[model samples]
Target chain A: MIAITIQQGRLFDPANQLDVITDLHINHGRIIAIGEAPADFTASKVIDAKDMLVIPGLIDLSTRLGEPGLEHFTTIARETKAAVAGGITSLCAMPDTDPVNDTFAVTELIQRRARQAETAYVLPVGALTKGLKGEALSEMVAMHREGCVAFSQANQPVVNTQTLFNAFDYAATHKLLVMMRPIDAYLGKDGVAHRGAISSALGLPDIPSAAETLALARLLLLAEETGVRLHLSQISTARAVEMIHDAQARGLPVTADVAIHNLHLTEFDVADFASFMHVQPPLRSQRDRDALRAGVKAGVISAICSDHTPLMHDDKLLPFPESVPGISGLESLLPLLLALVREHILTLEQAIKAVTHQPASLLGINRGSLQVGAPADIAIVDLETDWLFNRRQLMSAGDNTPFHKWPFTGKVHTTLFQGRVVHQPKLA
Target chain B: MFGYPGLSSPSLQLNEAGKLKHLLTLEGLKPHHIQDILDRADGFINTDTRQIHKQPLLKGKTIVNLFFEASTRTRTTFEIAEKSLGADVINLNVATSATKKGESLLDTIYNLEAMQADMFVVRHAKSGAAHFFAHHVAPHVHVLNAGDGRHAHPTQALLDAYTIRHFKGADFSQLRVAIVGDILHSRVARSQIQVLNLLETEEIRLVGPKTLLPHDASAMGAHCFTDIEAGLKDVDVVITLRMQNERMSSARLPSEQEYFETYGITEERLKLAMPDAIVMHPGPINRGVEIASTVADGPQSVILDQVTFGIAVRMSVMAGIMQT
Candidate 1:
């Protein structure tokens, strides 16, 4: 009944106790065992993975694939290919699409497209309002039944406190995880970038660290009061980490994730006003980046996400603050995160877990763990391989990243989505 | 070419994103570049002290203050700083000139360009008139918008922020700043709120008679406060505007005496602020109409200092923009 098999690989399987060295058996698209298998273990084919690192495929809890409505940024084909390039097997897309994902029809359409793309799976988050207009609640129950992963209105916040509290209560009653972007909209109005010495000196648009942290504080309190499961996306500022830490310590229903861009870079990158680095929350200060690293090291932010809203080059390639809100995360997610491992900030295992198992737990997906009975959706990565990133080679329809031509390591050599190689780049 | 220590030569920026670029008004910009111009003017200032001054980095570039708006305070002070910066000076109120041609702005601009104008310091009563010139002129030309038709008076607002930062310190996340009077017609208050919100200043309030303050004031990131005493309550800085006589017929707001009695800044009304809170006015104050003389000339008022900083700040912006 089974077909695929892999041999001789340094396995860092946290879910099983197999550390650094082992073999995995695959049969009928499931991991049959780890360690050297007996002679009777039959397979149609066996590939040697003598010096590779096999980890559970990564999942981005709150990802942005600008498609369906805004296909100019990225279509499903390019985004899924970008996801596989970064070793991400699944991505939970934001609900803030055109016409907004407020109903069952939108969520199902995303899944249907994912199946056709033949790459990463897309779990859609239905909008919490009639049209994400923040006026009234959409049917969380019916959408959840239609395979909506959670009720999410990601980047746009529920401005009125009453409207937000109501969304939380309805989500709690329906046992749905509600994801929030967490910015005090009134304070965030003229703010085009994170406020700091650079922003002060330039006389450019600025948003204080308080704009983000304050809304997080309000959401944490609301979660404590309403008993709703809350997920905070793109925790950018150091102050936000402290607030979320306190929320988690008090056992509030708040789980948070950090964007790779926020953790690895800061406003200094935008000093030349390189439109590529001109992102929303406009890259934090260096001190904030250090704090975020320490936050991840200390486990305050339990997951690492891409916050990957793809914008076409026409939207980017402008002056510093006027460029769009995000960088293409799916393509660079692995290399950038691996840079953290190479920098000694995170162990390779720790790095893999953040993008993989940790986000899996946050998204409540059954994937992202390499257990004996789990589906054999493994990413075979060559940890020591080096490659150059050409913007032209990127699969995402969006070609907007500051690291357009940077050299990178830790490339995914072969990716098995469901025990079949879906993506394979020529080995150097 | 002009030179200042640490600042580069007076470089003309063909691209809107170039450093030291002037963003006086958006007239000649490529539609591809208009939003880029608005995007650059978004930075906040941090000045240390109760009386804010300006950065001295633009010291060598000349900034002529060519204001036709009859005002001694803003004019003389900017002239003072141009001299301080070791730059040549000229203050021409072109109100007597051919500006009334409905003369295309560049005709006036070309006459000045012939005079080796590095920076054309301009002020007109019409909104977007400066932007019109900024766009029509060559990239080598730079314009300073002193005050334009209810469009923007950016430098004034910069000085207000500098003064606020000097007095209130770096955190505006919780401080309440009330900008009262003639909101619909005053570009000074309008620009001030834009800069304040960009700095993420909390509790910014706009107070005026309903006829003076437009319904859209709230979108500008300020609570539209109608009651004077209530709006001024517990505020840190209160900026009052001089009543524009030209708008009297159309304003249809309160009469001068009634306005002073209703929305005017008074010593009694001053009690509603945090003690030691400073008062500001972009003057020729409407002496007894929009504000009582006692508070206009009160102990806490930094009205004159605001004037001094205005010249220095305008020179800084003029020189910096000219350099770009």
Candidate 2:
């Protein structure tokens, strides 16, 4: 019975490449009409867009969330809240956890949990190999039939080259997407951040760029040779992006997402020696960040993900050499990225596409674009709202955000998932 | 003085009175005195252009290191440096002693003290344990603190200053050195900061989360900030600290994602510092957490050199104590 209308609102529909003055209509949890509200559509709720742009719910194909091993780090409930805040209606989660998502049971559990959160739709990534060990192929075929949209190893690198090639072949045969973190064990051994001058100064063990670049280089060959689809979970280096760009030109079915943390920050964040800034496939150089950012604009990196690793204080309080690496982005992902769009550094369409259509297409999801007869999954954001990040207001279960006091300019005013209000941010 | 453990109380400042007093923790330490000791150490280290690389400063003295904290690098540096100065050195595995007989703390100290111990190099579990014992015994017994529970490792600080002085040359009067990382529970930081002040270093900044830094550290003459860029701005030397996790028993930290956003030191942030600024950290670094591997392995990052110099630093510390 919550019927609302926006008298005037500018709308940007990327799918149709149209910018029009359209008033969207919603009733009983579905968009009954879009062009105009019916005469019978008496208003219980009404919103005037005021000529601000509106689009379909954003989607991210790759996000680290609902981590099974450490619920305290991030739970389905908190992640869903964060997802809604980020304007993301759908996401594909990584499969590397304590037990892993190699089996269909785990995938089903993830879907159930996301549903319980009642916020966003979660597509689980089934493990490519049993337990991500890469010794034997996982039942990718079976998982696809079981509603697992993609297959990937979240944190673990595909160690065996032949096994990885076989995985690509298997995924292609099944017409399933396989994602992997690009890190070569031999080159990245015991390394954390980008391995070069910074490492000598910080006294940390070194992780060579070859770890990221070589992995992509090898992945390119694997995809070309096997003619299979591959998705780099989080591309953190420039060389990886260039290699991927070349592979795409070569017509290899390869796709990648730059972790939001990777795109937004660089290796410099760790110069302060703050362990919380640490991340896997560690934050790369500024050149790498610039390239990754450019990749998003150039269309080489198709999506951006919040490689959110929710850790209570103890996890990061350890000596730099012993602390865990990862960041939480569910809460700040949209605002931080939107600020970029606001700055005109990136077009809103391109940015939205990175979070939505690009990622949605990667997952084969029907949720990113606003089309006639599509589900009314919507998110209303305050385009010009401004607020400093206090970390206290974020929905993350853990309070360890790196942007504790930084100011942000975009915020989710209201989030509707499957035509239901899941989160309504307090007006600033 | 560079021979560390070479001169018995070089009187680098040569303040009046008593034999060598071990500095384990600076909690109750006269903030002004830590500087004087370092000045004394520096004067000697500066004069010894020893191409001989060998000096008999602490000659004939017997040194024993009792390390509850496992630091082969620190321990080795001391042993090698002390031996070079012609002192007999011994290391004790005290961690197991308590486990076998459940010996109390004092009993062990008394036992060690009776072994005709000329100078004791102690790294213990208690913050001020070394300082406590330094005052407990007669003046003849000399002690040098290697490290103590999240307290102060004075010798470590001396070596850090020694390295900084080596790079910056004598006077640190106006030098800006930022210590980045877990300062709240870092014994190395506590001592390092004290030494930075001792060397008259100005603009000593502590960069990390409010949780990672000691509250009111600014009162201790440090400019505190959560942002690395702001902290790194125009700084001459950047000393990155290892994130201190041993202090946390359970959990309540922000995600690594959040931390990296605000604190990770990438090449971009490095531009904020002077081009020649060096990076320093206590060993066992979480590369990506506190620092990105790119910068940690980068040229400006003096981390490896810090590790390399750690040997010499420790060598000097052992030399000083044995000299007594």
Candidate 3:
């Protein structure tokens, strides 16, 4: 492979607080030199990155790449391609796959598939329990050795207190990062949308804020007692944000991420009972949305994720409640986050950190940085390009997104994975 | 804060001219909209009482009763309403329809539309099912929600409004109305509140156990009361809801007897209301669970009247949409 040099672009590397105009040299799939390069360095290929903002590749904390089971909805190759196009160079593939990734073999299968796809890095998260039934714990140690970045029950809540305690105990011993999507199973029972005036009027069964807060409080305490490294995913309520902040202030080894949709949308978005707006730990009130944004600003919420669960078209064609929960989020993730910066809710640096260094640091991964000798994972973004989001233009199989036809002001121009150009816009 | 205007149902339910295109929910309905439906229903009430007659207003139209969920009363009333208006009516038991044969709801809708149906009366167990139909149906066609899960039952609200206007007078601003029992699972209660609020009613109270009340029940322009007596105090009307049996299995209520003992509208509880107060129920009454036999059978009980008004209100709604 020829060495590549990216020239004269404004760079923003959140990991080291480096923001300046610079040139980067890459060789052997690593960033060989930045700024003043070695005298012997010569680039065989050059990428003119003028008029772009180069940053460390975005890292999503959670994503659903339906592979090894749900190939009809999505596959690792398709989803990772979409992810890279949206500026995500790496993502934690949720363990809630078919024949759940609770064992070393399943984790290894994901690794092999991601390698074969050559789209982007896939960090397989091992299931916290066998079959994710909340019964016996999975072989965490063995799965971790096989390259599972973290362990989670995915969207399913662990109903048994003892089961959760046991899993936390084991994870604590191993110093493993246990990611959880906190929800009180009973409180959210069969509920389709947020409990509010809108839900009441729409007559949809509602999942209340209490459901998230109560479950989050319990999990926070459990993490406190177990001394486990907890990374909470996709928290939706204001109270949940407050709880996570207080826990972190008390020095508990806990970090949390809010989904991008939660910050940009709310229960009002689901007012017409649009099936695309349906999501687990359902879209909440406006107050909660503002609080979540504040949490992100205060640095209490360390990252923002796609929570990118995709579904087939028919899956959303049924009645709202009967439809599956999730949004096809990967393709829209970057534009939506950039929208926050455009709207002045977040600064450019803050938005970059939320997707890059913050999430990478939470997972204890060293990839979301622009350090010399680091893997050349990078994204060049056009900060002021306006585009329309249409599902037909998406790479993933799932065309189910609430943001269809939404006008966005920022976009990813090109992405590189391990020094290889994986996704770039086609010439007009 | 989540009050994004585009998130509401009115935009989907009404046309650009603010006319009802589809009756999805009673929310966002103006005072005149409710008055127009009630006045049209009043004319029907007079005609039905005066003579055996049929109107040719909807004579050329074809109405389809697309019931995905069973509701003998709602379906029968809609059928009667369509037939009385002289429209051809078809009742489909969608439980055994092409939907069960692996057909999607939109596909089923398209097939019926191909048959030249002009209107659809949709009843589904999921909330927003009717709204879904309205969005996908042909622009010339209209949708009327018989009931959709815990969402609005607009015709039920209209009839309740008609029943109140017929007995207690058209002005609801000075009227105090109390809706008792299972407010959480009652689409009737949700729709009723929307209508009552639009009418600018003086007070609307929701009475139920905390477990059976929606979290934001008070936000629907009703005061929430745990005690039946407190909610019924000097109110001019009472609307009781059927205790949904399915909710009991989910443990929302302890037992039918237990629910009746705590929240049921007995004669003793009725005395707490005003002397001329009327009683209403959108029934197949759970005789013991939601109300006592004497109260349900009493002179003040307009429960049967609500059923009568249901047909007229549904007819008025269908006629209104066709006119649009």
| Chain B superposition TM-score per model | 0.81, 0.80, 0.95
lDDT of each: 0.72, 0.69, 0.87
In model 2, the Cα lDDT at residue A80 comes to 73
Q: Which candidate number has the best lDDT?
A: 3
Q: Give the per-residue lDDT of model 1 (tens digit) for B195-251.
A: 677666888888987767644444355688888888999998999998866556644
TM-scores of the candidates are 0.63, 0.64, 0.96
For each candidate, report its DockQ versus the true two-chain complex: 0.04, 0.04, 0.59
For model 3, residues A1-428, the per-residue Cα lDDT tens digits are 66888898788898888888889888889999889778988898888888889988889988989887997657899899989988899999999899899999999999999999998999999999999999999999999999998999997889899999999999999989999988887886878889887787677888888988888988998998899899998999998888888888888878999899999988888887788999887888999999999999999999999988878777888778888889888888889988898899999888889999889888888888998988899999887788899988988778889999999987888899999889888999
Error of 3 at B129 (Å): 0.4
lDDT of 1 by residue, A1-428 (tens): 45667777777765555576767888777787877675788778777777888888788877777766877556777788888887888888888887688877887777788888877778888898878888899988888887788887676778788998998998998789888877887775665556654443333456778888888888888888899999887888888888888878887867878888888888656534456676665688888999988888888887888878777654653334444667777878888888899989987767777887777777787788888778777888888888887778877777778787788887887777767677787677
Error of 1 at A266 (Å): 1.5
- Selected candidate, larger lDDT, 1 vs 3: 3
The superposed Cα distance between candidate 3 and the true structure at residue A210, in angstroms, equals: 2.6
Segments in model 3 whose C-alpha atoms lie over 4 Å from true places: B1-4, B47-52, B96-103
- What number of backbone clashes does candidate 1 have, counting pairs of residues 3 or more apart or in separate chains? 11
The A-chain TM-scores of all the candidates are 0.96, 0.94, 0.98
True contacts kept of 1: 0.00
lDDT by residue (B239-275, candidate 3, tens digit) is 9988988768987788999999999999998999998
- State, as a TM-score between 0 and 1, how close model 1 is to the true structure: 0.63
